[model samples]
Target: MKKIFFTLVAMSAILVACEGKPSAATKTTEAEDSTVLVLFDGETFNGWRGYNKDHVPGKWTIEDGAIKINGGGAGEAQSAEGGDIIFDRKFKNFELELEWKVAKGSNSGIFYLAQEIEGKPIYISAPEYQILDNENHPDAKLGVNGNRQSASLYDMVAAVPQNSKPFGEWNTTKILVYKGTVVHYQNGEPVVEYHLWTPQWKELLDKSKFSAEKWPDAYELLINCGGENHEGYIGLQDHGDDVWFRNIKVKILD
Candidate 1:
């Protein structure tokens, strides 16, 4: 009886010890099961397509692990085979990260909370994170106080410090959207931040080119921003310029 009691106590203690801590495999699984979603896999266009279209435009292609947009030198007119491309999923609150590089005089943009309006351009329903060769692009000198420059809110607000690395070097970009608050990060620094569906936002829109009197359709959309559901797609603009993007990923916050 004494031997059996000691054996049972030893077994109980072992079981309790095992239950107190997780195994190595459990720890590894928890570490590996991340919430981040890769928007591009470097080889395939699995979750992307042209905005308002069923297929990716031919001007956009994967080159050397980056999404490269072949330029047509037509500015915003875009190429005959080019259009904006977006991920097929809609996210309400997320943190999107990517790296981009542009050729001399190139221009592009990253759009968030975008809606697909038939025959309407992506900028009509989305806010853009301006990407440009600030040193060579004419738009860098345009807008009110350099708002059209790289890392700006594409004319609504200017990115202070204007830390774009010229044209050829890669720059890391991050866009965080959570509960009506949006922030744009460039090269690991916070550049622009704004809130949606607020009086200040309305005031900003009213003062900008998308005002109710100037562009009523865009004003209506920008006023609401994310629509009834407050969810929208992520998009990359093909502004008829040579641009490259890679390491695109997003982490859902909602």
Candidate 2:
């Protein structure tokens, strides 16, 4: 009986050696870190779709591992779907990370707290993280404390000026929202930061175009936590010109 037991133990040891434990590399790739948010993978469209609607137009295609707006793409408007792509899930306070490259003369922006008003672009309802070919686009040189360039709040607020990379190259942008503070960072540096509805911010809104157009919404910051909702969707802008995006991701904070 002792001899049989020894033989069985030896066999078990051999089996363990043959299989071993998962390698470090395998473990790293299999388990996604909760803090990391990867928006697009080259092969599929997951965690995304069109805004205020169910399907995305065909223009937003995946080519060469990037989400791009090909010429003559699809949209509800028939003008190559110049709408936004959004997270099916809403978030309150979180940080977003993404990469983009814009063709000369193209334009786009990321929008948040996205509310699709009965019939309007999401920009009318939510705040924007501006994207533009600053060197080529006409709107590139137009703001005082808001609007006019990349990372600005799209005509409502100006992002703090930092030299943007040339067109067709990858640019990294970070949008961090926690409580009443909203910040825009470019290439690992913060260019803009603003509290929702402080007197100064409201005054800026009061004097801006948003006052006349997005009037009530302009005052929304005055409400608690932008209407007591700390969570919303992350949207990509299809600025009707042409743009490209990849490595889109987000990390939610408690």
Candidate 3:
């Protein structure tokens, strides 16, 4: 009888301890909850703020599950009157992940810290993530010099080949920027990594078109371009080609 009573008490104590513990499933859910994708969940416009409210042009829509930018809606091709959608908030040091696919011969870009420069064009102030159909785009002919091609810094730097994936299929890309280092990744692989203020980078900038514009510290472009946003908006371009973007998300790291 005493043995039976002791067994019952021990079982009760074990049950109480188990009840206070969190299950493995609960832990996995907590980890997932910590990560948040910034892009819209569905083809619906849920997490974005329109660019230039009254001046927003073009027809921006969600088709099947992606954000589709139909050309000839409001702004002219490569013009200032086009439409742009930005995240509700701004970030400084973070990791941005998204999937994108472009149409034949089309051109567009994702700009980080893209803002207005007093005297230059809008793009001049913003750093661009080149989006294009490399096989069919004109910029591809320029070889390593053109920034207008796929994965290049839109006239600033040429993204090494390993960084760009083939066209048509969806490509997963990531941009990690922290302090003086900026790295580009394509399809989960790192292609090019550069330090912002290195002499080699500065020499390239000095010889590049950036010198003509005249900024005291040219390398400052990376830090100063996105005016109000130290970590600026994530913008998509309607390069007149049938480009599509979806599965956009971001995680801000302090």
Candidate 4:
């Protein structure tokens, strides 16, 4: 009888100790309850449009659960006509995740802090997270030290390890921006990280194609860029090749 009584008391004590504590599953549920915006619904372009335009161009389409683009031509191709697309909403600091795949020889990019000038393309003033077929694309061989390859800061900084999967295979990318610091991840590995608007960034920009004398358009657009205003649209480049993107989502950080 005493043993039974003791057991009951111990069980009661345990229950009391756990009464107010949340379980792991409950914690996960609470975490998920936080605000997250779905940029691409996998079926329609409910929250995206061409830069400075009211609608996405004919070359961009929704197919097989992916936001696909297949008409723009490669390198210096008629960009003003096929131009890039931007998220309908602008974000200052946020974490974005998406899955993307490219056809052989395809080249494209994702841009952040992207502001659309009336007649300029997104890349003119924004920093790009390069998306390219390193094995086949010629631009992959043009930038200094792999800076133009997949997951790079596009001509300004190279992603270490250059960890891009082969063409036709989907690669997951996560980009996080908070308080002027940015990071890029490829296939779950962090490959690039940098602080924006700092002296180092300024130097990199000065040496990059954005400010190069040979690239007059790029140089002019970024000539006066600064951090006084950092919030802007998220963009996908229409680089005149077939590319696929899906599962696009973002969480704006406080």
Candidate 5:
């Protein structure tokens, strides 16, 4: 009888202890929930707006659970109503994740650390993650050794392994920026990694089309990159080509 009573008491004590503390998995999930911010809620443009404008462009819409650009197929010579769009908030160091797919022969880009200069385009003040139909888009063949291909640092550094899905298939992308280091992930694989504000970065800028002689304004901005604040808005390009993005989220990193 005494043994039975002791066993019951011990079991009750164990249960109390377990109930008092969350499991490791539960703790991790809670931490993730707290740090993550849903850039798009998959329903409306709650935290998005046109770059340099107050509202989202009419060309951008939610379709089939994704933020899609209804392009005229003109390729950057898009209508006045269509342009790049950006998240309203600025992030300094973060891990951004999204799923994207492009239409046949389409061209688009994901911009980070982008500043809104009154007359300058988004790409002028930000680095771009190239999005394209590698099999059909002319850009896939341009740039040095596929630097202009999907997942590449647009016209600067090529995404190694070149593992972009074919047009119309969803591809997962992750952009991690912390301190001065930037890493691009494609389909769960880290494809490109580089550091900003370094001598190597300066050399890269000097050789790219953003060189001081070619585009002085862009060169000046690209040199400093994120400006004095080291933070900027996330933007999506409307390159007059149909593109779809969904599951956009970010986790601010310390």
Candidate 6:
């Protein structure tokens, strides 16, 4: 009886010692730490779909653990059926990170704060983070300064001293959208930062291509319907060039 009593006491002591310990998942989601979410499983299109489509586009496929699309050929137009793939849910404020690589002469983009609207392309409503083969793509030479270069906030801000790696090499990108402040990071460095819906932002938009009379609807989408709808899809562009992406994740902020 004494041996059994000692065993019970030992078990009770062990249980008491573990009463305040945290599990692995609890360690990952501490209140002081941001809540992380994996956007891609690296195995299938579990939570992704072609922008505005009911299915993953045929041209996009899961291979070697990355989302990939094969283009027409080197320097040829993208003939693939892939248009754009977007995370199905909308996010208001988040910090997102992903890895990407583009083939030579290729172009692609990452878009956020996108509100899907009928009769419009994603670019018509969302802002893009440009992805390009700077050495070869014609667009690399056309924007005011280098605002359209890879890792730039597409057409609005230039990422100084461009840090993109060479073609076929992997690059990491981080995007943070908190309330109205937005920041873009490339290759582990912050490249561009700005606030939305401010006077300076309005001025930037007024002077950019986005302000053309041809896109009054786009202007409205960016400025008018001004609530959580600003919280919209996260998208990957199909610039008709070959591109691959993986390791996509996001952390929500309070």
Which of the numbered candidates is closest to the native, going by highest TM-score? 5
Task: Mark the 10 consecutive residues where model 4 has the least summed lDDT.
Answer: 22-31
Q: For candidate 4, lDDT tens digit of each residue in 17-95? A: 5655435456334236464788888888998888888988778888999999875566433554576899987788778
Task: Give the C-alpha miss distance for residue 188 in model 1, angstroms.
Answer: 0.8
**lDDT of candidate 2 over 138-176, digit per residue (tens):** 788766653768988666566665557889988999887
Residues 138-159 of candidate 1: C-alpha lDDT, one tens digit per residue: 9999989999999999889898
Residue 22 of model 5, lDDT score: 40
lDDT of 3 at 66: 85
TM-score of structure candidate 2? 0.77
Which lDDT tens digits does candidate 5 get at residues 18-89?
A: 644444445556335677888998899999999989998899999988999988866443456799999998
Per-candidate total of colliding backbone pairs:
0, 14, 5, 2, 0, 1
Question: In candidate 6, which residue ranges exceed 4 Å CA deviation?
Answer: 1-34, 73-80, 212-214, 224-228
**Which one wins by lDDT: 1 or 5?**
5
Q: Model 5 Cα displacement at 246 (Å)? A: 0.2
TM-score of each model, paired residue for residue: 0.86, 0.77, 0.72, 0.83, 0.88, 0.82
Consecutive 10-residue window with the lowest summed lDDT within model 2? 21-30
Across 76-155, the per-residue lDDT of candidate 6 in tens digits comes to 32333557788998888788999999998888999897776655778877889999999989999987999999998788
Q: Which portions of model 3 show Cα errors greater than 4 Å?
A: 1-31, 54-56, 73-75, 78-81, 116-122, 143-147, 162-166, 197-201, 214-223, 227-229
lDDT of 2 at 38: 73
Strongest candidate by lDDT: 5
The digit string of per-residue lDDT tens for model 3 on 110-201 reads: 87655533443335555677787778877776645555567766666776663555567787778766554566666776554655546755
Error of 2 at 145 (Å): 5.8
